[model samples]
Target chain A: MLAELMLSALLLLVTYWFIVTRRLSSAVSAYSVQSWLLGLVALALYVDTRLIGLLLFGLLIVSVKGILIPRLLRNRVAFALVAGRETSYYVRFPTALLIGAGLSLVGLLAATRLAFQPQLLPQSVLGISLAVFLLGLFTTIARRDAILQVTGLLAAENGLLLLSLVVAPGLSLLIEVAIVLDVLIAVLVMGFLVARMRDAVAGTDTSELTRLRG
Target chain B: MIDPALLLVMLATPLLGGISSALVRSDRVRYALVVPTCLVTLALALTLIARILATGPVSAFANWLYLDDLDAVVLLVVVVVSTLAGAYSIAYFRSDAQGHVLRPGELRKYFGLFHLFTFTMVLATVSGNLILLWTGVTATTFAAAPLVDFYGSHEPLEAAWKFLVLAVAGELIALLGFLLLYEAGIASLGSAYNFSIPVMEQAGPHLTASLGAIAFLMVLVGFGAKAGLAPMHTWLPDAHSQAPAPVCAMLSGAELNCAMLAIVRVLSLVTPANKARAGGLHEALLAFGLLSMAVGVVFLISQRNFKRLLAYSSVEQMGLIAAGFGIGAPVAAVGALLQMITHSLAKSLMFFNSGNLLLRFRTTTISEVRGAIRVAPASAILVIAGALAIAGAPPFGLFISEFTIIRGALLNHAWAVGAGIAALLMVAFLALMEPFNRMVFGQGRGEPLPARAELGLGVLAPGYILLAAVLVLGVWIPGPLHSMLVGASQVVDR
Candidate 1:
């Protein structure tokens, strides 16, 4: 349990770094690392319980979400009409870092108050998951670029996965599959949309579709 | 003695038809295909409805698939609306630029996706488990998104993307709410994790008060979105206005009904203990319902685009349903169900009529779509009647249903009922009157359309039948359906 806590804490740190900083590659790498550790935990759970479903699910995550998706996105970024560099956010880097630290601290304090088997994950994991969810939503609203918003969307889904780990044990194999499928489909559809948007107009700022302004 | 296997077949048929539509290469043949398929599905759905009403919520197809009095009522609406819209799409698409612009494969994609969307909605309503129901909605949205972008134009694409993002995000929040609901269910049913609505309703009072309240609010947000109620209804206008007319009808008429049915499904499960402490849940629904009505009306009053106006009417109608359900009285709930039926017909008629308008004018701008009485008198009359019916003017089914809702609202919760009905009436009245006035009275300046621009055969027939059905339901609901409605309403809550 303590080992799982350590791993979760590590993930929280990386997720924070990914969302707080404005670098595109950093956010992508952070999520991929998060996925890597998630596979580890799944593997551990599989070994402990001998639930073959866990092994299959873990492999599914490793191959599809971690490897295949990231590769597809990197290729799209290099070849597709992506704008230069990463987009900036509504808040500054220094302040966002402070805020992230505060969120982690608050999550830890909240974790201490909760009563769950400490072997699963620390309550602070929920806080970090929630905080990551918030930051993802924050990025979607704050960033001007559609690509950034799409990244925020993926980040939010990451937070959902984190929450699922803490709350549900192994009862929901299909549920997890359904959620991930939706995210994959959403990203693919959004990719097509980004291409179309750039073709129609020169950029991908969605706010410009305000043709029906008050 | 009707077999539930037929119900499963009925649900799956339109989907099969949709798939068949995509495989064919001819636009003309593709256009003709969905009609027979819709009629067959309707016949099967009616059979299912009849059997359920006769036997009382027959176990259809499999153990997980059950249709109670509530499901019977909702299923009827879904079948009726989809059939009509399928017919309308034939005419609606061919007259527009898409008929010429669409590659043969794209036509199949649209029709295939259309049936896929219908399949998910049916799966959602018929499923006995809450998880399956939720997943069904999610699947439906994915299936429907491509339909929203079927025009393959930039605006439609963007709208479809935005709609998917907003809806899926709201659904995730709803799932969080569902998790809370599961927690409460655990507290009540003692860790069995039963997902059936009937099982949960019996187990509800044992659940924690705070947990139930949280779940209630979460449902309101989640289903409230698909219901197209305020604060979460950002996608309706853009998607509806941008989608093809028949697609608009499906979205406005059937899709929203399915969402509202979901909320009521959960409501049926919430224990009286929850309702007693959470007195304000109904009030919150009322608030959102009224907000939806007022917002839809305000937008409708100012709108120039015909399809967008219809989209707003959906908001108004959904609000009325919410108001009816919010009152939570058996009488009020029945009224809400009636509202669902009437609104489906009236709204579809409005869209079909608008389909004709777009057919003639080649533009959806209300300001430019005038003198329809001269343009195509038959379609013009249908548009005017549709407008009047949706506005709840007398003789139309919506008028009867709205009257019932307001009357029931006055009886059960007088003050809220009176004020909500008045506000709704005012907005809906103005809403239907304004754009329709332009459609019927204003000078239409566009050139006469070619014969190809006229209403197509595959499209015009289903919409007319739907209009007839709406008229039939308005004047008189058959005994079996009415009996089911009463049974379902009584089971709502005391």
Candidate 2:
């Protein structure tokens, strides 16, 4: 339980790093490390439960979320690396971090309040998972860079993955695999759209994507 | 007894069509491949519906894929709209290619993606497993994203990006909801329980109330976003307006229904647990429904773009359907199901008309285009008719369905809800007709009319067919369709 709590704290730290980091590359790397930790948590659960499904799911997470998606995202935004951290945020860093912390607290409180079966997993894991989920959503809204928003979504997705691992690892293997595949496809599609945005709008900032509003 | 093999055939037709269309370089061959594929899929879907109606629900592949009365209703809407959109795309894209708005290569991609989009909707409809259903719904976004950005222009790319981001975020929430639901089921049914719809339904009584409530709300907000219910409906207008006309027709007419179907399926499981829980779910649906109606109406009154006008109208109509189901009376549920069909017909017809307008006037702004009748007489008349029909005027299908829904609300003794529906309908009717009346009839603002552009049979046929269906359904629903609607409603009423 202590080990799981530590991992959860580390995961939360990585997500915070992702939010504060201005460089797109660093944000992506933080996401990668966060995904790896998620995979590690899954593996630890597998060790305790001896569920082969969890074992495969852990590997799948590490390989897909940790490795493949970040690489793809990096390639898509490689040009933005040299462009020197575009300076436009709907919310500034400090306020965003404070909001993130508040969201984490809410997640923690909600997890405790809910009548989650205690024997399924550590309560802290569930709380941290929800926190990461909300932070990811916050990251998407607060950042203007399209790539940052995508990472935010991925972060949220990782949070979901963690929650599912703890709450319903008994979910069918086919479904777990299919969900991963769906996320991969969504990332691929988002990456493609970001590329198109670059070519059409001449940059990847979502602020310029204001043409379609009411 | 329906043959399970038939289901496989129905699904495979589109999968094969999508692959072959992508592989075939020739435009003629691709059109031939896609159009027939849609027709074949539609025929098979109808056959399956008939069989299900006759013999009850059918499950295959160990209940991983199944169709009941509920699935049939959604499947019917999906197949009809997608088939029409498929046929209409030929004319739509041919014009685009000729106008040099799209190159030949892009046309191939459109057909490929179009069929793939259809496949995903079908998959979602027929998925017996909850997880597979979620996967299929999420896949629809990925499939349609490229098509939404087919123009490769600034506005479309923007719309596609927003569509992707918002939809993914919403579906992620829904994913969490499904996880919670699964956990709820495990709490009751043990870890060995299946995630199939029937299993979930059976386990509903055993579900923990708090967990079930949270799960239902998550699914509601998540799928509600996809279904174009406000305030999550921000993506609907942008994506629908920016997409090509046929794609708009499909998005408004079909894809939204598939999303709604997911919500309904989850509601079926969650609400069966107990009365208080059911009532709470109903209240949530009613609130979202009414809010969406108001949002759609307000936006409709101030809209500059005709396509956006139609998109907002969709938001209104979806709201009506949601509210109808929320009424939780048998009559209202039936009305809601009927509204789904009628709305699809009317909305697709209006979009087709908008496509015609876009083709001729080369703009979707309501203020810019005048003297539409002189520009293209057939399309102009159809546009007015479509506007009237969608606005719930008498002698149109929507009016009947909307009336039935109000009657259902009154039967439930929900007078305020009934009055709200009535008032919104009245304002929406006026809001809808005002711009369309101006655009279709008035003399131009000193701009030369395009000389009587000839709309091909391909484009006009779908609109006429849809308009005819909407009109006929207003007056008389065929016996089989009436029965199908009742069967579908009973699934919810249970």
Q: Which candidate is the best by lDDT?
A: 2
Question: For each candidate, what is the lDDT?
Answer: 0.71, 0.88
Model 1: CA > 4 A from native: A21-26, A51-53, A72-124, A212-214, B1-4, B59-63, B96-100, B190-192, B276-278, B443-459
Interface RMSD to the true structure, each candidate: 3.3, 1.2
TM-score of each: 0.90, 0.97
Each model's Cα RMSD:
3.4, 1.6
The digit string of per-residue lDDT tens for model 1 on B29-78 reads: 77777778888988987877777777776663223566777776777788
**Candidate 1 structure lDDT:** 0.71
Lowest lDDT block of 10, candidate 2 chain A: A77-86
DockQ of 2: 0.77
Q: What is candidate 1's CAPRI-style docking category based on DockQ?
A: acceptable
Q: Candidate 2 overall Cα lDDT vs. reference? A: 0.88
Give the chain A TM-score for each candidate: 0.80, 0.95
